[model samples]
Target: MNKGKGRELRAMLRDWRAAAGVYASLQWRCFHQDGRFDPFLDPATQYRKDGAKVRAGIIRQIVLKHELDVPVPEPVKEGEKPKKRVLPTPPGLSDCLAPMKAALGAAQVQMVQGQVIGTLKSFISNRQNDFVDIVLGSTIDDLGRRQLFTINRATAWFDLGRSVKVETVEIPLSARLLARKIMSHILARHKKPSMKRIGMVVDKRVAELEESRSATSHDLWLKVTVKSGDHRSRRIAIPMRSNDYFSSRQGERKKTFQIIEDRETGRITVGVVTDVGSSFEERRMAYASRAQGPKALDFGLVTMFASDDGDLMGREFLRKLKSIDTTISGIARHVQRSGGKPRDSKRYVAHVTRLRGFITTELRRILNRFVAVRKPTTIFLERLNFQSPELSRRMNRILQNCGRGVLRAKLQALNEEFGVESHEVVSAYTSQTCSCCGYVDRRNRKAQAVFACRWCGRSLHADVNAARNIGSERFRSIGSARRVVRSNVLDMLVTQHVQRNTGERGAPADPRMSNPHFAAWADKARLSTKAA
Candidate 1:
């Protein structure tokens, strides 16, 4: 057994040497063509001339000992698939050694590839010392990893350590301290819950949603079936406009609106096409729900964080960045291999940065709008602190570039200047519980955008519901096991039910209408519209 094991280990070592020799020969051939150490063709011809001869002799011995008759794989032609190989392993070697051999070969290939990239970098038109610095920094961190540093794109102006020339206002960190003082004064003045202040925002949101059906474009309406907790079926029509529309690559788009339905229960909202074009009015209304929606604010400043799906601040923006990064990476790889011009890399990066700027700018606008409308004494956001070592580099990059931190910092500065309160919420389960009933159940949220409580049968838009819950967390005893229902919650449920039924009923069969209740509702709606 010892002899067999020894022989196996020897065989693995032999295979590794053979793979390394094969890679070295390929590298040598490329170097030869590039006119490196010319006139010294064979190692034997030059007797100890340089290190190249000695290294070449070692590779030659390995190649000869292996007695390899295998033809070198042909260079892949443009738009052509390379032939796959199924090389048989030596009898004494195990499959475990395959990876080591592949790694050795890969290292050799990269050595040659690095030389090629170095040659290409010299040809860059506007290459500077800063570019060289970025390259060296990346190489020092992980020399084996591929770098996709684009210098030509529109966003190239935001290069690391470079001064950005865009006009911007500077808000001091001391503004937060001022905001805190103002919030403290407000708290001392009013001891109880600020239900009236919250009610104002809530009333506006509900009225807007109610009126939006008629005001919204016919193309923006979506009819979806969602299941109630009581094992009943319900159909709801919502004025839905998708926000996930930032695609970085040409001909590549992410599915922002996905509806996952439960097969047995049929308690899910589905059948919405997110690609439909949204008008200015439609976009304004959709964003208004979150940006200016009613909230149960216990503090002057509210630190809003994500529930289950993702962070509200930069979800769509991150999706856009991801799309752009994928496209840019592909372009970089293609350009790097084919010896393409630097302009191509710059162009792709520029497009991505422009899209990113638009998202961040819009996010700032929304935050500013919220501060202006709400005029809170102070605000606090639910801080996102979760991190795992298992996460991939790609995922980490996405999270970092998604602009959550940037938005948070911007909101702090903007609110500080306004003397509005701002802070962070360290609580959990912001999305699962119902603000009305205090019911905590994962099943309550049937879909990403739909929330239905099992305890109170309260159904509301998921994000709106979450915002309400987040705002009211400090004011209400959410930890209490007993279900607490509110009068306003009852009214909201009734209104939603009436709207859904009336919508299904469509126009009355008679001019007078059969349902007197609906007729009264219609009369009230008409009066409200005229009042507005």
Candidate 2:
């Protein structure tokens, strides 16, 4: 297309987009006020054909109200068979939608209607559970990802060392003595002093000393140059931090860049947007071809991850998390007593950030280690619940929100990078179910760590046993176990156990009488028959 025609088409599309927005807004408002819109919010309504007529009626009402132009059935002659009646555009709203029709074609108008209906349904459904509001004029653009702008020619380079500044300040003997005294006092107060607390005290003192040298300490600025077309390059100087460095070290530039400013601190930063490489699928497929077998993983607060292969990872994860939680709780309590918001406290925010960082790092490390050691084609996991009686309620909430999402995200990355697929299984009684005999019982779990089956007499680590059950064929065959009640699941397991032991096709026998191996084992363990 020629430049003139291309520009005209672009302008036409822009106008159509605006008109579509207005049309959608009017429809949304109409639906929002209509009672019929509530029923479609039900998840099951989409699967039913009964709502089609109701929806069509609602659409007709909107068409009449907006005076929208719609297809009408033609009338037949007097001698011919009865024909469908046609409706005309209301004279009252004839000119109201003239601009909308002029800019949008039939297909585009239908697209706008569908988009508005879907959005309104979603909004109504979500508003029932959350605080939701309609945001008009925020339509999605059809531009390709990372192709919104065209980069004709540009050169980029990184200025890493040039952004760094180092300075030294002299400390008086009296200030050093006072700092040592404070450290000694802090050490004496606690049985096991935290290095973080001591470091904070020292940093405060150093900051005070540095403030005294403010006349010598000057501002550090970095210059950024930008050129457009034949215009001269414009240079801008931004205040720089000691560690600030360009992220694009390879001198790579993309089609887009953004300037971000921190609302609270008023700190400005530059961001470069880059596209993801297309080789991700190739890498994923390559890993899938090489990897073999499935691995089941049991998530826990103490051990982090337990595998069916009898491996435990991140054994000290709980200990480290607990330590961080202690600091966070302390800071929170102090803020509460002062009647200040926890977010307004710098120390509280810092500790929370640290806690999140630690959780992300540990989760990434454990998952990577598992993939490397197990080399599994597929990973089976259960819905993670990090609630621990040992941790504070706040800490548990944090774990549930941050840890679960971070772990899943890491798993997705692993899938894309290493072709490892992850699946979630129903975990109801896996911890109590014996992996060896398929026997399910609450008494099977003797302790938090130990799994001693009452029926099969099999003994093993509880998490490992659960992991084994999760990866077993029996568990996988029970499709949609999440919908089944726990009691029914237990009954199914009991029936399976009876069938396996007695080779019976009829009613299930007594669990004890069916398993001969359990009888022998029980006799050796000196268990009473009554107890069995």
Q: Highest TM-score, which number?
A: 2
Rate residue 374 of model 2 by lDDT: 79
Q: Candidate 1 — worst ten consecutive residues by lDDT sum?
A: 197-206
| Candidate 2 lDDT tens digits, 323-427 | 988988998999999999888988787778778888999999888888877789999888788789999999998888888889879988787677788887778
Q: Give one digit per residue, the lDDT tens place, for model 1 in 232-299.
A: 33444455443343222123222223233332232233232223233433544444454533333211
By lDDT, the best candidate is: 2
RMSD, one per candidate, in order: 30.7, 24.0
What's model 2's lDDT at 185?
46
Candidate 1 Cα deviation (angstroms), residue 513: 45
- Stretches of model 1 off by over 4 angstroms after superposition: 1-326, 332-344, 384-399, 474-532
Error of 1 at 80 (Å): 85
Q: Global lDDT for candidate 1?
A: 0.41
Worst 10 residues of 2 by lDDT: 148-157
How good is model 2 by TM-score? 0.52
Give residue 459's error in model 1 in angstroms. Answer: 0.6
Q: Which ranges in model 2 have alpha carbons more than 4 Å from their true place?
A: 1-274, 480-482, 502-532
